[model samples]
Target: MTAAPHRPPGAPTADGTEIEGRLDEAVRAVRAPDAVFALSQDGRRTVRCGGTAPPPPVPRDRLRYELGSASKPYTGLLLAELVRSGVVCGADPAVVHLGPGRPHPRRSAITLTHLITHTSGLPPLPRDFYRQGLPHWSTNPYAGYPAERVVRAFLRSRPAHRPGTRWRYSNFGASVLGHALAAATATPWEELLTERILEPLGLAATALAPAGRPDTDATGHRADGTTPVPPLLIGGFQAAGAVRATPHDLLSFLEAHLRPDGTPLDGALRTVQRPVLRRGLGHRHVHTLTWFRHPTDHGPMYFHAGATSGQQAFLGFRPDTATALAAVSTRRHTGRDAFVATAYGLLASLPPLDRE
Candidate 1:
């Protein structure tokens, strides 16, 4: 495989060079294979850096990168739509939607809101999930597993804690939510996302296909820096981290979330972004139905990150300023503090919000 072409690193025009240089240095320090960073305010005054990837052949608008957990917000958005349509309630017991196959005595107490907030006491991933013998950090463990296997495993698994007692990231919880969404809508999960979310928002490049559905996609890289791996095919886990999208497409989605008045899912987007829980140390921060929120000098900021076998991606926005940032890296880097810092640094360079 060849590298994607390199775009000049700097501001949108002449004034952005300083901020662009900072982004370039940060991205370089992580040794990312390919990256794209952009900061925007009032839908203008944007600065962009880096190419899709280095040299071989990056598609023009289709630099597909696995969305990883970044796919969470999209799932959250779908749930929010369901909420708006009255198909499901954020605080309703998940068991009601999941049916009787699984003995979730406590499941009836866990709400869709708790799952999205990561407070359902579900572990980050299934305990036996690693027993399949895939590499610990393999970019695509679920590539070979089917949804039936996942459902069966989950049906017999025990909850780690009582519902809503505490917060624990749960890939299983998200997957379960996806299953419930499909069951309620009576449509395939991918098709529901396309019809209700992606298509409506004009996210033509975003989808749940693994190995990406031809055209737009970022190739996965191995930890050792071997040649890029084939696009990941994470079957049943698509709802957890299987999306492939570009920074531009993601930003449009973020804009719609931050400013929903004229968007396709206007009211639903607003409901999803509203704070529902206190998270992080000392509960100093707040979390919405799907997005994490932090207080900024300007106002509250919302964001999320994603990681797969060989890729990492981030998305964030400040509603008060109408500013947002989205980034993607072709190589894996688990330490996300640096990515968050880079995002904040980029946002700081933008014009401050006119209010608040």
Candidate 2:
């Protein structure tokens, strides 16, 4: 709705415009009713466009979109804190914490790193998760499922691959990692996130709001683009993708990732951004603890996207250039190609990396 701040000296605006133009084209092509886009370089050279909803005169701050899987990095940060405090080991197998009572023997070998990198060999979702019907999965798949059920489902199923052997992008793995972090720290998952990640960073707007909040929540639209759905609440899987944040708060979070110095979790942030697995085509697919890395002519960039019943969002940063971009769409467009293209395009438009 508001224009982003002006670009600082020595930053490349031409490239930034090219990327923004591509995103604008995408929004137009999708005919999306509501969307928000924000870009920043070292917290300056920032720009934003679009609004909280489609047309017709409702102007609101662009903070109501659901952050979807982008919440993983926050979960990863909490896990990192546990590691820093010596309460948990990044490489420790899940079995070590869940204990012998847990069902899956394969899980015995799955490490925190595996969960963070999506290489834990877990399924994207539980097999019987759909038995409850489409509304359940579509609106709030995990809302009714309890943590005990998650442990049971995990133990009953076998790993899709050997631990740490491949990347399959499992939301289930992240949920398990969240539980494990809480277990190791002797704190509730939400409280652990608040105390360690949110409070320290002063991210007051970021958190899993319970069912109702009056502050500008975005409504998810159906494919036909008419129906509006309530925000999906994944009960036990809160850690996997349950965060609601504004673009400004998200930018603050991304800033910490891009520039971790002076942060409480700098060591953990460093670990989270370090590439662990190569995925996608050409093995150019780079992945760190929770963030996905994109190889660019400028340098290695990191990003992650989130989606839910009603929202889609993306965050990306070029470490070499200290540039970051974040975007949120109230409507879920089927595939992620546009989001990826936008991020890559934006990064490409930046000035060449300075080889120091």
Candidate 3:
């Protein structure tokens, strides 16, 4: 349970009121048990919360929700930071830091850029994932797949296409990238992320599962809104989908990306936004190192959405409008759920504001 709210939903303004109403409608539309909507515009922020009781008036900042694949962007940023700091280069082979293994013939072609851009030709998950995850498939599939297992599986992986020639989303590739970064720095991914990104950004409420404050963790629920699901523990596949945080902390993260000029990771922040690959029909969709780049009247909208067995999150920002959004729900995503579309629509609805 959360504490009492210090302020009403959203900020005390016309725009704030609108945000509150929109968020309420969005949450209800999806039948989310609990949800939070956070927006940061030119550094100003508004937050709205809703769902079943303890009710919509519950404190917005205390609850931490699983971020799922949205964690990839953080891994992407770490890669960029390492590159910018000369710790590694985007062109470096992923196998260089993946520890000793019989190198794949195509290993040299799969660079950090390919891995982060989803051009590595790796499958969506490790070859052995289903075998290991079968029992826990519905609740928490990645729970027991350790790093050694992941490494062994990767060494045996045979992609149908050559690396960097195809754009295929791969949790395996992302997870390996996380392992590669950890290997390169001789530090665990969680610690490296905390020291390099989270701590610097003052994101005290963000961390890997079973860490941070347990009391603030949000309960994940199925579509029924009655059945609760256990926390998702991704084990070695953590980098692919294990990060969690309060809406306030996630909004701060987007704000940093929206305005990265003076930060310690400014170089890396800017690096993640530079278009890296273009795909989709006629090559219309664009991907940056960390986010999906979609053209809008207001420059480009960079965003990512992720979900676990029982929670969903959407993160997006438009630098031209100086706006960022972080929306999250405790309910698992269903095909018909409007949570993501609604969040994207809300951000898209905001007009471009004058920038300095």
Residue range 1-356, candidate 1, lDDT tens digits: 11221223432322356546655766565555566675555665343445335543654334766778989999999999888988877787666656656566765567777777787777777777777626744656776667766666566667778887787888878887787778777898889889989998999867677544334566667654445767767767767877878777888888787668778799789888788888567999788888888776556778888877777778888775577788777765555435556665555444442322
Model 3's number of clashes is: 0
lDDT of 2 by residue, 94-126 (tens): 767666454556777899888878888898887
TM-score, structure 2 vs. true? 0.86
| Candidate 3 per-residue lDDT over residues 160-215, each given as its tens digit | 68998888899988988888888889998889989988998889989788443436
In candidate 1, stretches whose alpha carbon ends up further than 4 angstroms from where it belongs are: 1-26, 45-53, 59-61, 102-104, 210-215, 335-337, 348-350, 353-356
Candidate 3 accuracy as TM-score: 0.91
The local distance difference test score of each candidate is 0.71, 0.71, 0.80
Cα-based TM-score, every candidate: 0.86, 0.86, 0.91
* Candidate 3 segments whose C-alpha is farther than 4 A from its true place: 1-14, 53-60, 211-214, 352-356
- Candidate 2 backbone overlaps, count: 7
The most accurate candidate by TM-score is 3
Top-down TM-score ranking: 3, 1, 2
